[model samples]
Target chain A: MNRDTVIPPLNAIFQDVFDDPSLEVSDDMTAPDVEGWDSLSHVNLIVAVEKEFKIRLTTAEVRGLSNVGDFIALISRKAT
Target chain B: MIAQKTASLDYGRLVRESRKLRPDGAHQNIRVAILSDAASQQFVPLLKTLFHENCVNAEIYEGAFDAIELEALNPASGLYEFLPGVIVLANCTQALRSRYYEHKGDDFLETASQRVQRIWDALQRHSSARVIQCNYPLPYERQFGNYDLKVPQSLYSVTAELNSRIALYARQRSNALVCDVEAIASYLGRKHWFDERLWAFSKAFCHLDHLPYLAQSLVEMVLSSMGRVVKCVILDLDNTLWGGVVGDDGPLGIAIGPHGDGEAFYHFQQYILSLKKRGILLAVCSKNNRETAIQPFLENPDMVLKYEDITVFVANWENKAGNIRAIRDTLEIGLDSMVFLDDNPFERNLVRELLPGVIVPELPEDPADYVRAICELNLFETSSFSLEDTARSELYRQEAGRRELQTSFTSIDEYLQSLEMKIEVARFDPAAVPRIAQLIQRSNQFNLTTHRYNEAECETMMRDEANYLPLYARLSDRFGDHGLISVVILNVSAAEMEIRDWLMSCRVLARGVEQYLMTRVVAVALEKGVSRISGHYIPTAKNAMVKDFFAQFGFEKVLETDGGSRWHLDPTAYRPPTIYITEKQRTS
Candidate 1:
């Protein structure tokens, strides 16, 4: 599947993570803006993000990223 | 739900990067001011250890003795200034337990308590500040003698005992809680409690060195238990537990076949059962049809808890929170106690906002994390756990006794006799130490003060003449022996007595043990020629069970301080409930 296939999965992840509907999302939205992007929470979030994109984020990469956009870049970089 | 949202956020990111557009104001941060006179050496480690960017974006306001002396913090005189989310009486530990002080026992404890109270009361008066009272941590082995040197510990040891007295005193103030820092510190080994790398101590246990995890954990404890009870624990089925949807795959086709995926789910199920066993009622709110959702319990023999194990079942087409509200109404408990756990993120979040008090723990992708998160919740930690804990599930299972409340035998008196309920109200003696100790640690939800005393401390309080005196009201209703279900600690000051702490177990809450203990305590107060009897209601996450306690006793509201609601009663005006039977005897 092309990168377009990733959109459906990413949409599902965003819907699940933020619990928002009829909404707008940008590649740059990060953990800082996310209401529940907590560390205890981040552990599972990253795991879900990785499994959905069919890619991986290093532990440091996962810890260092501050926003949602960073997650998208990391996923695209790894997936390609 | 998540897989879709993850795509939405990520897609927005791609457009912004390619289009070179950066969005503004994605996350706004809040600052939490941590006030204390603790030296940077002591406080900095705490800051570093608990420095969470997401949960609490905070600033540390390190105050000196002059800060405490400010017009803002002076309770006796100053306008009760607003307080922060967490106001830890941290430096008080050092001042009270200082090696140089050569103070007498009773006076020292009372004075320290008032001093700490002034700080807590002043801060609490502001309304926003949630106070955290910690007992002074004394390195006993280093001070008493060597690591191995043990002594015949005095009844109320200066450092530790004074801290405990302060803890009890703090409990007398509303919405103030005493974190058992002393007991936690006492258990810490050199490297276990403190982090050598960070050179910091865990606030979970106050040691010289600190770990960062302790900070987040402490914040969780402070926020979660402010003034609510976790009423119910709603659960999910299918992949959430045994790996496959029973409808799609059939009962035998499910992944819960013992050793592999089944083991993890089995352990998770058992863990949830244990929480239910502790009086946290269990309810099932699933999307599946009632018959299909319940079929697993009837057909699958490996299931740990059957359909009857659940207190409420809503398997129809309804919003998760709606189902939860119904469960709350049926159980007659609060939505706060309800902890909704579902593998689906959409369902968990729906309940979170609609019913905020209901703790909705995110079900991890892997069953292992799911199990870990449920058990390791420090907010659910009971300071005391005894025989009552393991037996709590059976007690609820047998709560068929509540049905008996409607129809009376003849009169109100006959109704009581029909349901053979036996209550053992005893003066705490050495014989009941084991059970009493457990009650002090595990009984959190209904505890008036939420204070924990070890066996040594419990024994010492009873033995002392000029200090604390404790009494336990144990109830054995028709179901079974509730074992030391209620506790009342009385602080004897000169000729007057104050009920320092009073609470009853949730299981036997409506049975009138408070009346039983109140009458007995008043009698003792009268016998001792105590001028006036008084008690205070200090609020906590779980102790809201006794919010209107003093008013219920007909005690006149004498002095309502920033600390808590206070009431006073002359022996003549006092009248406790006259019901069931009267049996009072002393055990020394």
Candidate 2:
């Protein structure tokens, strides 16, 4: 329910959606930092994240995210 | 395509498999064009993966988003340029909802139906691609609530009406087929089907999780159009058709009827009976003594499927996979075209491991869920139906009688001659076009050239009298009528007559149907003053039975290759085999 618990699984989802095993997420990382992370794969990422954390992200919350830090915070908040 | 159980249709696994897909050289390649109002990008991978699972390599063409009419109406559009064998029109209900809200007309239903017909007409005019028109899944929003049925103008009513119109219109056109996306949505429950957020964000057709089911339906239609169909349903007795074992429980003692502990089995029998009525052959493969296994069908008054309904009944103590192989041999249909349903997991797994091609659907532990479990897979999807289909079971039953009669005679000729068979070989007429096209598509084993000509192509061949002699043969005897059993198309020229396509229904096999037709062909060749008759035998996996077909008819092999062999015969030197079939006078 905290960042420590959310970040590991969130990073794994990122790696899976991008099909990159070596992928790691940082607080400042954004869409530009990841390969194959486009508008199309962004949907896949959101679906995977919702499934992994057993939480649904609202359209506003999904659009409001600016970086990996925002995604982690949203997941941490939703997980609790 | 084999139907997938819901548990195995994992979205993540399918997408990953699609990424790792390699072009299989042995797989038949088909070009498919998808024109949809919704986003088709997510669907392409699902379609590819499902088609690949069926040993078909699909090269898909995704039209620009929401350009169904533009691509269909324009002759030079990329859709026609791709020359798709199948054109899938995925009209999502989400898009239809928007259109329904925007429209301010009283005759919106009429306008919408007419627009769909126009697209089908334009596509038919432009290309020979078979159209797979999808029906709209009903919208969740019901403005009139429970009164939506009474309010004709409501979005819910319009969606329901549109689905019916699509099915009714598709019934009139041979090449056009309905995908029934609404049925899938209804099966999955509409609440789980519609993902509003995904639709608003990415124009997704439905929930990404449910896209594979939609893709499987489309693939079923496409594969059925290509002449891959399940012709027979191989069933197991005991707990499968009825409750408990007939071997020990006795015929009347077994639980089967409309009431009490037998209602579940009664419902299951009714479903199987419906399948048989639609021309799917039903065969009983039980692990019991033959007499005991069949007593329920004869003695049990509550049994919906009677003894005669079964085409090839095999009941013995032999391993079921071997019994199934014998059943396949008896039916002369591809193993892939048969479904084996057994209640026991041991039997299902045995058939699955051995046959691999035969569809073995796992039954539920509870008897009440039997019908639902089978229905969920949608195992018996087909593209064409005719009166011939209705009579197919009777024809196969008579074939069993013929086999019995054959054993009574020492000589094959005597047995064939005893049947007193009559033949009517004539030009393909308008009335026989449907059966003729069905034969062309379904015949695999006895077909010399396995050319799956659609109904449109068959109609063209029927009309082109100047260059083609497309003939259909109907056979009858003391037992029953085998309607339109054979199709032999000949290309006529001044120098020679060439057999372009030769195929026959296996039900009438060894009845001298082919020999009688070949004699008629030689006579026509001599009458027309053609010097030679040429025939080609194309070898497919199923048609190897006819590898030496031309050779038996005194046709000398002229050219040979790995693909096939060409045979030529001098019409003057051809000796017609003595046949028992009396030629019926052509009424025309």
Candidate 3:
């Protein structure tokens, strides 16, 4: 449930949804920072992260998510 | 040693598998467009994974969310330019309910049907894409409760009526198809199927957990439209059709009955029997002593399937892959049409490697879950069924007997004449239009032009005899009836007639049926005072067997190209092969 464990799998999900293998999840990376990550595909990314972490994200939580760092912190807090 | 995991594949598993789907090793290149009123972002990756499993390279187009009408109605939309082979419209109940609330009177169902019809009409005008419309699911409300069933104007009643209207419209329109998403929601319990939270937040109508199953149903529709249907199922004897090894268990010892572990095998056999009844040919490819394997089917009192049910039974000590190749040759069907089921992973893998086209699904470790595992695969997706399909196994079994009887004759002509072959040739009957269209889609090896038509297109040609001559042929011999096995679409003109498409079943090959068809063609030309009869040989991967088909009946190749070649013959010089077969025609 640390940043290292959560970020790698989150980056993998981002890579798959965007179809980019080299896509990396930095702390400040937002939706516009990643190619092919539009509003339509945003739900796919959230559901994938929820699936990987074995947690559920509310609609408010998904809308509130701004960056990869915020997503990692939420996962860490939800995991503990 | 039964595995805990059966066919209930969760959403997480599908997503995990979808992420690993890379562009590699796919043979077919297909473009599919998804137009939806709900969140359809998951369909691309989900369908890509499913298509990748089938070795199809799919370029899936996801339209803007809630833009089904926008993309479908506009002639200049990207969907038209994409020219997808298949377009899936996933209209959710959430959006439909909003529209229903605004509509007045019992015209809601009619208006909804017309809206879908407009999309089909626009697509038909602009592109050749087939439409698959998903019906709305039942809404969760109990205001009227049981009274809603009796009320004709209730929203629930209107939705049910709308589904039936759309189904009826799709049946009339060849290029239109309907996917019963409501059935999927009902099958997977309502509690698990619909997630109100997801719908409220993301506008995802169906729950993400049930999306994979919906994706599976959509995949079946897409594959069937492309004529990628599984025709035959090859079953293993020991540990597959029964609980214990039949070789050691004997007929009495085998576990196949109404109790204990035997019930599992009995249920599996019953499922297989259902498939056979619906025209799927059954065959056995097992490594066992011939009599030992045959004894169980013969003497087992609790056996759900008898020995006569199988079209081709190959039971020996030979390797299953080699035996499967023999079965493919004997049945004369594409390897892709055969599905091999064995309990052992080694045998399944061997066939998978040797015959990549053959569908070899990995069974669960336990015998009790065979039916569930196979049902999940959806091996058979037929568009039409008739009396001919019900007797398909019997016809194939009798054809095998004919093949055996031919070896005793001194010449092929003598064997064919002694069989007393009769062919019923008709222009086109309204009742047989569905079967004719299905034959056009399924026939590959003996197809001359490889032009596939849907029922609507077939019916159009059937109605217009002045310009188009559509003929269907049904063959029967001393053995049994073969039903409608041949179709020819001819473009007629004042001076000449051209064969637009000619296809026949591979089972009736070398039977002089094609030659008899030439006689009919020549007769038509003579009656109409046409100078020439033209034919074309379009080359495909599987249709090379018929490259010289037109030439065999004295038609000369006039135009040749890399794509195909055209053949023509003078009507006076046409010579039909001498075969002792009688022809029946529809008399007005």
Candidate 4:
């Protein structure tokens, strides 16, 4: 899987975790930009992303992500 | 109408369902307070959805994270202020592991268990809410490998020991129950259960995927406490309990034995028989001729469920939903309390679509998976058990015999006399407390005032000899012993004796059990020098059969309200009716 392929599914996951069907992710988007995306729902986002991509994220990898770009990049690297 | 569809425990579906739930005011309202050492935000939605499936609108309160002790010990904490009916104490293994490493002594298990007991004590002292304590799932990392079982100080050993201690302690306390988180973890496999990253990031209890199963177990316990239980299991004959069709393959030709292809059906029969011994009445509904249907039970040498074991056997070419309704009517129980098991999908779906309250579990394709499929559903959750429960089926069977004899007699009086029923009316003893409390919880139709008192409250009433006249009656006939069938609790004052709680088992109805007990109540009132005896009839959905109960007994109506009507009788003017039952002399 590449970055372009991971973006579409990751966008879907964000829309699902936040329960917002119209949600779209941008490169600079962070937790504050998304509604209902708190520390608690962030966990849900990680779980849904891991399930969708069939990859496990380590604690350091999970905590180190800063924005949507970092999330897509991490998944693209590990998903394959 | 109650939804009989089995709710999926899939985490995603439950979460979505939780978001879309609209509160139904017709549903019963329950308050639940969740106190956990880990974060409980993820669990609230799952609990709400599961309770909604059971026709309950749960008002949930999440205690502050890791503040179990702080909230329970303080009287004015938000936990008590919420006025919850159930308090769920969820102690996670990840948090316990941290506490184990920091503790300095070898008595780690003792200290850990004592901390849990102290929390239960404080909760009980402050509020009357039932406590559901979660036992820790054993950690996967075993330092000594297979030798972990030998080390008492290892984290693995301490976790296992704490689980056992939690169950043993719950057995002694009536209000406390154990939610076996370890069993659920083991069933799902421990490797998939532990998600360390999620725990590290958000202090989640388990993998978010498995949280719905945990929530389901709690919902089952809470529902049982609310007096929603499975009282009867309706089974089908064909491939369900045996290997082949009984009509096609003659009784001797059918495969149901301890060997070869029949072993699966044999084991299934054994499981059903065990349920019968536990007081769940068994009924049969099959699409076969009456003679052909019962031939297997009579002729098959290896059959585990005998003909006598079944309370009602209906074998005809009728639709299954109609037969199930007949069974429900004969048993005098709610449709929601019956479980129908049929291997054929057509019959299962027919019952599901028609009788929306009967629990029809989908049977697996193979016969061997029958027991496993039913076991996975955990459909028979209950709150109390007693010796009377074990003898319940036999009492029902004896009732069938009495019914047959009544048909042969000329009048009802002659039939009642021929049975030679003996009744023992005595004060509540320590040994009868469990059955007394169970009767109080389960008796719905015959109950005058449905005051569901727990075992501890029943014991308190038994000990207060001056204020309470808590009496239990046991009936025995030539057929069988009907154990602890009726309970009448009276409140005594200087001027009058009031009937506080009066209920009897529906099995003993029309058998003069109530008539004998009422005679005993009047005699006790006269002996106490009370001027009048008063009782109230509170109306409920199921207790309409007893609406004119006091009026039939010659009591005059004194007060009427929206709640119910009250009746009063002059003790001196009360005439004891002619009852066929003779009082049994107490041996003790």
Order candidates by lDDT, high to low. 4, 2, 3, 1
List where candidate 4 sits over 4 angstroms from the true fold. Answer: B1-7, B400-588
lDDT at position B4, candidate 2: 42
**Superposed model 3: Cα runs more than 4 Å off:** A1-37, A65-73, B1-26, B62-64, B74-77, B101-110, B121-127, B141-158, B196-202, B205-210, B243-253, B257-261, B296-301, B405-478, B481-588
List, residue by residue over B450-493, the lDDT tens digit for candidate 1. 77888998898878757777888766655456667777889986
User: Which of 1 and 3 is ahead in DockQ?
Assistant: 3
Query: B233, model 2: CA deviation in Å?
Result: 0.5
What's the CA RMSD of model 1 in angstroms?
A: 17.3
| Candidate order, DockQ descending | 4, 2, 3, 1
Error of 1 at A13 (Å): 32
- lDDT for position B551 in model 2: 91
What is the model-wide C-alpha lDDT for candidate 2?
A: 0.89
The most accurate candidate by lDDT is 4
In model 4, residue pairs whose N, Cα or C atoms come closer than 3 Å (at least 3 residues apart or on different chains), thus clashing, are: none
The digit string of per-residue lDDT tens for model 4 on B485-530 reads 9999999854889999999999889989888888889998889898
lDDT of model 1 at residue B398? 52
Q: What is the CA-based DockQ of model 3?
A: 0.26
What are the per-residue Cα lDDT tens digits for candidate 2 across B372-424?
A: 98887888888889998998898788876676577789998898889999899
TM-score of chain A of 3: 0.90
After superposition, candidate 2 runs with Cα above 4 Å error: B1-7, B404-478, B482-588
